[model samples]
Target chain A: MSKLNIKNLIKSFPSMDRPAVNNVNLDIESGELVAFLGPSGCGKTTILKMITGLFQPDSGDIILDEQSLLKIPTEKRGVVMVFQNYLLFPYMNVNENVGFALKMKGVDKNIIDQKVKEMLELVKLPDIGLRKPKQLSGGQQQRVALARALISNPRILLLDEPLSNLDAHLRDEMRDLIVTIQQKLKVTTIFVTHDQEEAVLLADKIALIFDGELQNFTSPKNYYEKPKNIKAAKFFGGVNFINAKKHNDNLSTNIGTIHYKGENYTDLNEDNIITIRPENIKLSKNNDFNNNSFKGLIKSVIFSGTHTRYKIIVNDLELECSLQSVGLQDIKTDDTIYVHLPSDKIWAMNE
Target chain B: MGGERLKIILSLTPPLLIIFTLFFGGIFYGFLQSLGYQPAIGKYEINFSAYYNVMFSERYAKLFWTGLGLNLWVSFASTFLAAVFALFGALAIRKTFFAKTICNFIYSLNLPMPHLVVAVGIIFVFSQSGLLARFASQIGLIGSPGDFPVLVKDKYGLGIILAYIWKEAAFFFIILMSVLQSLGENFEELAQSLGANRWQRFRYVILPLVMPNLFSASIIVFAFSFGAYEVPALLGVIYPQMLPVMAFEFFLNPDLNARSEGMALSIIIAIIVMILVVFYFWLTQAKIRKD
Candidate 1:
């Protein structure tokens, strides 16, 4: 296992004025799986490509175990990527594809065969070595790609949205398979994905990127509960923003003032934005629940399978509130309700 | 079902008749003549005498064998070299933007040019008294134009081979460019990441993916080059003429009985081309099955 460090990496295409990857810095510890989570065109894949030596960075250093990787070519970098389409060579059988890297290294045939068989068994496709890639299903092809990538014992594995092409059920299965194999091999891996759930489920730490910048890098729990910015906050789930003016200890807003006391702010200021998650805001008919409670009208009720989401109109501000469908009574639209905004859960940050 | 079948036959009749008359009809007449049944010469009995004379008889046997060897050499050499050069050209300019546009323009510039014109151009540029010789003499690189290497009308058939390659490479490039464009660099990138070097990537991945198209395109080039006359006639030496040129010379002979021998040589060239094409197809099919 080797530590992968990316220091101030930047890249810009000649066709575009703005750089594709802006001075991004990241440190992936040895044997840690980090997921680069972002929307489309967020430079996740571009950064992955640069790390793998497919794309050259305009400036900065990719230090792997205290050595710069910029001078090394792609094949010598010991970084393998499982492409989104699982680009198995159409001319080779599954075994040949899996053992290609070893063959390229001029390994003995008997050893390569043994390693390829072990890898096939590891990916749980043990008896289909002679079958061509097109003869396999989408999920089976994914396994072949995985086995091929892992058979070479790469220093760092890069997965470019490996599960996006699979069906929903296959996505879950492949996700589990990847995590299990990643842990077993203990290879330092970085995976790019637009799906937040996959990142959270598979990564030890998630790096949220937006518009070619790393917005936040932390654990999945921190991303949801304690996001560093509005962008990272909105990525995990829905967030309702309200403009507020801070006065010493109390913050004044359109939904009425509340004694706001979240630790996101150090000094009380005039201009601030208050963001709260929909699931954290409790809706009830009784007013004696919490300190920062307000009377509101339910504007709309959306009944999802897992939960019922309500849009509550308080004064001129609309706040989205979600309640679990289990152990909850029917909440109708146009009904009067009291929405509680917990002080600690309401995160206040400067605009 | 009978009515539908009749409608289908009616719809296909016009094309079938045209193909049978213009294509197969010519082939049938040539085959009859090749077997020594030229009515114009008053030789009505159909036998294998014309074929035997063309292959083994004293008069035309040496010329026939030498022409066959030249035909094979020109077709195989030009096809192989053109396909290899075009594959490299296509790969080099596949990704770069400015180079891609410029190279695409230069690559297809000769596609619309006639082979005879290209042969004439080659002579003007490559012959002993050509522009290159003049330039070399002007620069004082050699004593005179005679010191310049002979590239055209030489015994080794270098002039005809060069002209064929220059013209046919563009055809191969066009086919390869389309294939390369449709197949993005994803596979190459994957191979690179999987520890395959540049040569390995091309040999194991890029070549195989684009091979079927390359083989089919080479077949067309080979068959065409084997039977094309104008380029070879314009730029060839008289000692070992290409098969097509030799066959056409037989037709021009004053003796009307020689027409059967000419047709026999034409039929021989056609058979060789068909055999090569079938062999190539069988090889590609076996590869596909193995894969």
Candidate 2:
């Protein structure tokens, strides 16, 4: 059985015209780290809050271990959330902040002290327990907040944009710490983040939401290659979308007939739109001797440090292709190249 | 930077001059008088006789000690009770939008009201022959109009304390409401997620967060209540009056020598309040360091 199951969750505020969270459902297995991925105001945090009982769902059932948690109060729900701003109590030192949950539970002072030391060590922030929160750096404060949340051994750990407040380098360090501690403890975790890269890097599975609706929930690789809709694909940086018609084993678009061999196109209607990742498109000088090949002119080239992005105009369609910077010295603007969209790499969705 | 400093100094000169001349200057003059420098009476020699008389003299010693006790009682009780009431009031209405708006309007209504008006209002409502006393007599709760309890003009300074609490709780409320509203529910929610119950959240999070502001505001209320003269003069009894009222009584004496005693008493009140403030800061700082 799943460790946490959210069934038909719905919530709305009177000030909003639409529901803040629509009928959203998810099932997270024990010891699996999931990311609620969405843009701001997309109801990802709302679902996290609903699970923690901070914001009660207008209607739904949140089940943990086959028991409904709808009626449980926030403090009794056995769930802890680390906020985006690292809401460590300013008045308390790191020791008191980290050991606060245990103290509230009436644990002995000696045990709480021992556990706080251990938790701090887990976050690689030991010996700073005597310092107040304001005295520490941002990364230190976030680590302390993480240690504070983990001290209680909660059933579920929720992190709401935990890395949003950190700089680029610190975010990577904190991400590694979160993953290491999560895997070591094998605790069920759910984090809310709008950064697609962060979601892909940290989450075992990503639950993509758009406008308060659950758009797709799948693995990170699947979200890149096989999004449920165009919005999900666009959110993951999918810019090459071909509006086409699927006829048996091939797709017909404004450019020409394109041959694809994917079972996903079978259930798709005749009128559809096909999407392919930029990295999946092959750009070669020689004409490939296969299906799904087209002659195109390179319109523009943006050479980023890691990869070189190219805008290729193939007939009436402008397809974006990214090639690694290793051996791309030969490709430049106005070069006629052969673009090949691999048969298996193409995913078609109903328009 | 030099230009900015010049601008700041130029702008601040007006207020600085006013404060130095009117406030500190007045205190200096009063201190000189308290030390027996009454030039109006050709008494140029300065000494501590006024202070000694106020403190250890046989004639005024009993009145001085009892009046100091009453002043301390009224100030401490009113400041503490008003703070407690205002804190709970702020916390209760912080999350309710409609109630917060209405309660804020009603709570702040007492802020601009003159303390003298409030004292008179207390007298009208709580005095023996006041409106409440007459209402109680009509309802047969008491035997007659004269049978009502002596709530006002009593030895404990209940009427004076009531008036101060009623006026000062609004000041405390405004400060607390702004702090609580600006803080929002973030800290409380964080505490709640840590498995802390409601009371624990308040004790550990809310109370500590608001303690500094509450303490500072209480000091203001305490100092004002201890030194203000009108409320106690209107509501206090003939004997064992508050320090401020007793000092005023000495000033009202026809003898010009009595003026020095009144100044001495005022200076003593100021010194005591300053010492208490410093002690309070030391205590809170020590507690914070320990934490």
Candidate 3:
């Protein structure tokens, strides 16, 4: 494990008006497994490529242990990447592919063989050493790619959406396998993913990127609960954006005036907005629960397996609230329910 | 089932019939002639005298042997050199922006040029009395044009080999460029990340992936260069000619019996090319299966 410092990295393609990776900076600690989480074309992959020296930054410095990597070529930098499609060498079988790096470094045949065998056993595919990549399943090929990248004992490992190509069940299994291998190897890894759930599951810290900038770089719990902006909040799922007027400690919206504790709002002139996730809004029949409770009519009910999604209308504001489906079978459309918005849960942001 | 079979045969008959008549008919007639049956010269008996005469007879045996040797050398050298040069050229210009387009245009520009024109072009530029030799004399590189080296019409068949390499390198370039473009840079990039240098990546990853196409394209260039008569006939020494040139001379003889010998020599060249292509295909297939 090694520390990777990316300072002021910027890259732009000739055909694109905006830079592909705009002035991005990240400091990865030793033995940390961080995920660059964002939607497609959000510059997550670009950041990973820049770190691995596959794509050169227009101007910036990538330092590993205080040593700048700008002068180093890709193969000499000891930074390996497992591409999104698992780009295994078609001419080589699994053993040769995994042992390619050691062989290139002029390792002995017996040592390369031993290391390749160890990698295959670590990846749990000890019997597939002689099978070509095309003959392996997508999951098996992904394992081979991981084995190949990790066999070199690289300073930093980069995974470019490695689980995007597998089926749902295989993706779950591969996710577990990757995390286990990552822990066992303890290599400082930066996993680029667009899937929020996968990011939450694997990353010790997640860097949420959007439009070539880091929106939020924090733990998965904080990133999900307290996103930096509306765009980051909307990435998780249904989020309600309320145009509200701030009055000292309270904000007035179309639904009702609620308690506001965030510091962004100052006066009536400020464009204060209150955003809350659907699962944060509690559905109740009693009105004496909280100061932010309001009576709303249930507009529609979507019966998901784990929870019941209710579209409620309060005044002119249409709101979505999900309640766990424990005994909510009696609830139907047009039922009047009191919705509670917690004072701390409502994130206030200035537009 | 019978109706479907009839429909399949009907769909296949046009091309199959044309191929059989043109290909099999030619082979049959050539084989019969090689067996020494020529009614025009009133030799109606079937025998292998023409094949024997071409191989061992005192009159043409030395000429035939030397021609075969020159034929093999020129074809093998030119094909191997062309394929190697084309592979490097394609790799160098595979991803550049301006140079890629310009080099592709220039590379393909030579494809439509005939072998006869290329051979004449080589003679015009490389001969002792040619433009380059005269230019060297004027520039004081040589005292006179006669001081220029003998590159054209030399006994080593250098002129013929140079002509084929110039023309057919473009041919192999077209084949290799398409293969490299389709294969893309993803694998090579992965190899680089896996600690492979540029030369290592080309040798292990790029070369192996493109080998099958290169081999197939080489077989085509080899077969053409081996049997092509125009390039060598125009730029070859008379003493040690290529096989096709010798065969053409046999056809040019007034004796009708010589026609059988010419057909027999042509058949021999074709059989050699067929065997080589089949062997290369089998070798590549076995290597692919083993891995």
Query: Which candidate ranks first by TM-score, i.e. highest?
Result: 1
Ranking by DockQ: 1, 3, 2
| Per-residue C-alpha lDDT of model 1 across residues A191-310, encoded as one tens digit per residue | 999999999999999988877888888999887777777788888885688888886677888778877777756643578888889999988877867587999999998989899899
Tens digits of per-residue lDDT for model 3, A1-351? 799998988999987888888888889899999999988888998888787788899998999999999889999999999999998887788999899999989899999999999999998999999888889999999999999999989999999998999999999999999899989889999999999999999999999888888877888887656666677778877368898876656888877788976554553345667888898898876676758888999899998898988999988788899889887747679988888888878777664
TM-score of chain A of each: 0.95, 0.96, 0.93
The residue-by-residue lDDT of candidate 3 on B1-291, one tens digit each, is: 999999999999999999989999889988888898777778778988888999899998998999999999999999999999899989889996866788898977888998889999999998999999999999999999999999899999999988998999999999999999999898888888889999998888999889988888888899999999999999999989888998888899998779999999999999999999899889988987686
Clashes of each: 0, 0, 0
TM-score of 2: 0.95
TM-score of every candidate relative to the true structure:
0.96, 0.95, 0.95
What's the lDDT of the predicted structure labeled candidate 3?
A: 0.88
How would the candidate models be sorted by lDDT, starting from the highest? 2, 1, 3
List the lowest-lDDT window of 10 residues for candidate 3 chain B.
B36-45
lDDT of 2 by residue, B1-291 (tens): 999999999999999999999999999999999998999999998999999999899998999999999999999999999999899988888786756678888887899999999999998999888999999999999988788888789999999989998899999999999899888888888899899999999999999999989999998899899999999999999889788887888899999899999999999999999998899889889977775
True-structure lDDT of candidate 1: 0.90
> Highest lDDT: which candidate?
2
Model 3 chain A: lowest-lDDT 10 consecutive positions: A262-271
Q: Which stretches of candidate 1 lie over 4 Å from their true place?
A: A245-252, A257-261, A267-270
Error of 3 at A299 (Å): 1.9
Best by DockQ: 1
